[model samples]
Target: MTKISQLDANDGRAELMTDEDVIARIFDHIDNGTTDRGQSSWKEPAVNYQSVDRLDAELALLRHRWIVFCPSSTLEKSGDYIARDAAGIPLIVVRGSDGEVRAFRNACRHRGVQVAKDEGCTSVFVCPYHGWSYGTDGSLRSVPNGDGFPGLEKETRGLVRVDCLEQAGLIFVRQNAGADRSESVPDMPDLIPDSFRVVKSEAMEIEANWKLHLESALEGYHIRSTHQTTFFPVQYDNLTVVEAFGENSRIAFPYQAIERLRGRPKTDWSANGRITYVYHLFPNVIISTFPDCMQVVVIEPLGLERTRQHMFLLTDCAEGGEVLEAVFKGQEFAAKGAIEDRDVVMSAQRGLKSGANDFLEFGLFESAIGRFHTVLKREIEIPAF
Candidate 1:
């Protein structure tokens, strides 16, 4: 196999494999009748996917680590904000008037009600239950009926703060209030950029474990059987370039069109429409590239058997006409393939209840999934302070 180092040692930055490098690996696999593989197959117990205690442990771990919450472009203006639940932690990420990004507990100090709902531009977040207002900076701006409460110092009643960091055009948050407020981040690739604009944003509730949805994006073994009508014709059945950096990994699903570069100059190779790269940003996020748009999917566990997936489709193309139409078409195609994966995962979730097997086996072709589980086990066993 022809593999290239994906990390720059000089600055220790994680970079994607070049288009030419990716093409070479794809060709190498095609000629050798082989795909990326691990040393041995692994079996994961089914109880992890159906245990409430296990779900709680995973949720607690999510609060301690830096997880991608949303794209930075989602909050363009100073007052723009997004309030939602991240792994059961209610958080509001807002751009303060001082032009700095901050995150706080969405709950109001009075009556423990949420101060904001959904997302929008707001100078003040007012609790719908009692009209308690808070500034974008999360200060306790004012409280109604001043005389009803004596010695209610607003300064001491401000919203509790959470750790927040924004880099590479994405926003990340640590829900742990006592978490170290350092600048350390994971080995993340530059997926989002300022030029990319969010064209669609939506949330989905999946009746399966959050990991199930993430496992769907880590391999091309199911492309032919699962995405026959949607992705098989354009992509290879089991050909992929799998590379890992730290705890993160990128699974490249090259399009059949890449064959055109067989004899072309390396300078002429561009990845734009010739391949799809699914970047697993560790833990719970997958940033994938399509021919027309880039999709960021964040998976959140709702319960033992439920999960919430937040999807953002972004594009750098101009608005309207054939170009815009192609973007929509690409989005539709990706959505269809997602539905196919959803159905299969849901079936697997159902199988967990049948007790047909104590453990679910993963083959060598599913090496990325195996790596994910390995990292997850190590993280879960480590103490979170």
Candidate 2:
């Protein structure tokens, strides 16, 4: 029942309202016992979660669109590289000596075996299968035995390159080379400051659909019941300020302590410890802010019922014993909440297979989820073969 303004016209993103503006809106909703609502609700077919054909279409859409590969800070040095599977295709992102970031198909040009297995620093990637070496810039530097093949052109045999863009402290990779190569990365430099450093990272494979995990993060309607013992005591339930930025969205989850800012001057108010800003970058990236660090989660879909989640914890504190101690504590708190949410999503995935309903209903309180489905449906249209 709360009235919110439309997105900004210039940038296609919601305006970054001040702390005072957000706090006032939260209090207004609380006083009226109302929540934000979308233009309308949506009904998604349950089969969309279990159909193999649907999964294929979804993955195809992912390959053609721009997706976040990893945080730019992950590849900090010239030789640093992170390799992983994206949209079912193995990808390697490396920082070149010239300080430019680039992405390439992980497969070697000769035998197609992945040259880079995991994240590490290496001057050149030498394929384990055949000793074919490629430079950090993705050019084929050496083949074990040049005479084995006659008139081999190394320039034409370099590793296949994918479209890559480094923007706003994040690295984005388009899985397929021919997909629209235009650069449209969301502005995130201010949201993720340069001072921040990656302090910790962890990956998990979940037995659930990727979209289900993302839906859990998009709205706070389930916090009271699902995270009653973990987050409900500190953060409100079903209360969020959602804003759209092109295909992406930002949700503000305010803590109970936010009420303390009521008497402070608007200019003096800070969102640091009182509110958590969760930014969703289109297809499958989440950047969340905490008191002392930022948590970045990349949702990589493996199949209709499988997903790989890569999480990174970042902090900006000066190097010191106390700083390390605080960073660990912050990570621990974030991990606990993540575990709680994971359990909820896994259970939802299991229930969806029970044939209890033909369609999964999304109510007004879960408008963000509706918007996510809207975008997904628009992008996953099956083309004529």
Candidate 3:
């Protein structure tokens, strides 16, 4: 089995096993000849997420839309995320009796105290704050102090509610605690493609700015140096980048050159067609795809200098084998090289805060980074701050 990391350093683009270079060709060329590079912009990074301002809103959004995992449709099991409100108060997001979702502040109305944590199907939420209890629908069903407060209205005193929307297999919430659910619902897409679905995932904590870490995953310019021996770039490489919203971008690369140089088997994947996409959504979500697999990363900021990297891996391989090994080995090799990229960006974070390196650079080839910086500029603007 040949690995991408092991390729001849002397081999240049001219040596590609094409009709021009190869004494032979694998098959007849289609009318459209192959050359790599996707829709790319020539700009520098100026996105809003790069600054310290947008951090509060992004964190607020993540916590409000608590219990975001996979649909029971894919996992065949229930999983949820219960997190805190802006006031550091916990909230519960779970399936109710009708199998519909519900969001309730994990607090008691009678005496203003806390409720449950860690999710499971409970008929009702009995607040530990007081002997007060609430149904899954967030109704104040039982109260121990029935006579203590004669005028107390159970209807008026249920857990404080929050907003939620499930789209593209993601649960999103508003940053404000009392943000309207109807208004939030209006902005969300009602349907989602399975392509946006997820499989196995893990979360990792790191010492870095959230945008610094997220932006790191959106570009491939580092593949050549940082991933030299461990990935395709060391042997054969190229890039094609596309810009998204101001702070978001995507890059796609065809694996044909490495396949030819490494003498790997011809796959249905086109050397010149069927490009794989690496898309970065504004703020903190990214989806990186190869032909048979995709890894989505959702970032959570811990502080000014810390972030949690939650990665989800989806693959066509139902089980592992040598064939799967060949593909995922390429992925793991790529994954390891990310550490090298991380070292540089994390250091960049520490350096940028010093205000000396005020201006950053981007290349004509790095339009993706340029788009990223642009969007970040829009998101971080606050009238006061």
Candidate 4:
């Protein structure tokens, strides 16, 4: 609860770091933060725990391989800012003064208290827990009572940085998942083209285990039946997988054309039915954006039965570019349809948690969702550690 000033009793000489230092700090966070800490929380990871199908669980667990933990995925769109500390839970993402990304544990190395709370950014992140202050570059530039803790490496003791990558307009963070780290990124970039970019994103929470919500996202088999009012009339062509990994599957669909839906408001046109390209990243993230057509990324876990979807609106047509209202409506309808999905995903989670359901079967066309589970089993239960 204390501010950095309180600890920086000799705060007179703390100078600001250079922009190049910030960039170097960005890479440093990625390479060095991998060192395992003894205590981190994982009570509700994205994997499904109750199911006997180790495959299902491992498929969800695979995404954890790339998580850099804490100081990764700096949210720049919100302006240069970072998530405070890990608090024993992974999720700090900060932007250095130079505008490069850096993620931290949100925890102060000294007292282990979170430096950033909720979401906020600062040029120099000073831990409120004590006077330990770090520049945007992750250097322990200032610390009060320099005489204490003899031999303490001020420069080396700054908060740890997690490994991260920004590709295809998306950020990837590396993680070990309680074991040794995974070497490659499963060739995710190859599956998607350079033409695609994350236009925008929002996180939505749903009720259910992370895996359960992911299962629902993996397949669109329940599209017609689950989203009756929103997409009942649209042709539910089933889901297709473009890539499958040890614990992840990438699926894409051809949503119906924008012009096809004739008589409807933009918001309700989702009922017109259209083809869509949806990508289900392994483990926790889903990049289900329809390039220039639609953009969305949904997270299936926040808490138990809680998931968040990062929604974005994309377009090839420039601002003021000529496009029919019907076309716009198609995208609108598509978003409406996804809202319907949240309800079904949440409901499915409730059913699974109930003892009444042993194991819900995936229809033939909805097989990718099952394959997603198969991948989960491979990654999570292994004892490679």
Q: Which candidate has the highest lDDT of all?
A: 1
- When summed lDDT is taken over every stretch of 10 residues in candidate 3, the lowest stretch is 1-10
lDDT of 2 at 119: 91
Q: Which tens-of-lDDT digit does each residue in 150-196 have in candidate 3?
A: 88887888877766555555555443433323333222222234543
Q: Provide backbone clash counts, one per model.
A: 0, 0, 16, 58
In the order shown, what is each candidate's alpha-carbon RMSD? 4.1, 4.0, 10.3, 16.5
Error of 1 at 95 (Å): 1.3
Would you give me the overall lDDT of model 4? 0.49
lDDT of 1 at 221: 95
Prediction 1 global C-alpha lDDT? 0.83
TM-score of 3: 0.64
Relative to the true structure, candidate 1 has a C-alpha RMSD (angstroms) of 4.1
Better of 2 and 4 by lDDT: 2
What lDDT does each candidate get? 0.83, 0.82, 0.52, 0.49
Select the stronger candidate by lDDT from 1 and 4. 1
TM-scores for every candidate against the unseen true structure: 0.94, 0.93, 0.64, 0.66
- Candidate 4 weakest ten by summed lDDT: 1-10
Q: After superposition, how far is residue 282 of candidate 1 from its true place, in Å?
A: 1.2
lDDT of 1 by residue, 164-196 (tens): 888888999988734456575657667776678
Select the stronger candidate by TM-score from 1 and 2. Answer: 1
Residues 1-385, candidate 4: write the lDDT tens digits.
Answer: 1112111111132322232332233233333532111122122323244544543344334334563222123254433563522212444666665666655555688878766665565667677866788776677888788788889888778887766555544555543344445444544444334433333334455666666666666665566677777655643334332334333444444333443443444444441124344555555566544424545453534444444544544443343335334446666776687667766777767666665645565555555565554444444555452
